[model samples]
Target: MTGYSALNMQQKQAIAQYLQSLPSLVELDRDDGVGLKRALGNYWGQFLPEEIDSV
Candidate 1:
């Protein structure tokens, strides 16, 4: 398996938290698809709370 799959739950959670802490597109001036995709991929399986994601 690739190194990504080897990440432990805690590591995943940390990544998620880091992602969640990032500024939104408007705030960061990163409204492009590539920027958004990069942000999402950086956190992979991590999901934000519904309220936040819905915004």
Candidate 2:
């Protein structure tokens, strides 16, 4: 929890109440039968400033 805790102690504290329900949604993805790891957060500047498909 070091990575998350460092960024948002207050936010982390708030979501702590729901810790008991932290089951993996990926594990329950019945449609695909093979769940994929979805990356969280916005990467506004990680790659190119303009996307070819942005048009």
Candidate 3:
């Protein structure tokens, strides 16, 4: 449940830059869908299934 507040200024800037670098629709039919999904999962939630057998 970490928040964006945990990211440093540099990290935030890097993310912004990555997002901005996406190609326009005319240039590419698809973009970095995988990276975007991972980033969203990390920023929004754990996204992983809970462990059922933790000791």
Q: Which candidate should be chosen as best, given lDDT against the real structure?
A: 1
Evaluated at residue 48, the lDDT of candidate 1 is 44
Model 2 lDDT tens row, 1-55: 5665364545554444233223343244453332211211132122223347755
Clash count, predicted structure 1: 0
- In angstroms, give how far residue 6 of model 1 lies from its true place: 1.5
* Candidates 2 and 3, the one with greater lDDT: 3
Q: State residue 28's C-alpha deviation in candidate 3, in Å.
A: 6.5
Q: How do all models score by TM-score?
A: 0.46, 0.23, 0.39
Each candidate's clash count: 0, 0, 0
Model 3 Cα lDDT, one tens digit per residue, 5-48: 78876677666555545443324333466655556456522433
Q: What shift in Å separates residue 5 of candidate 2 from its native position after superposition? A: 4.8
Winner of 2 and 3 under TM-score: 3
- By lDDT, the candidates rank as 1, 3, 2
Give RMSD (Å) of candidate 1 vs. truth. Answer: 5.5
Candidates in descending TM-score order? 1, 3, 2
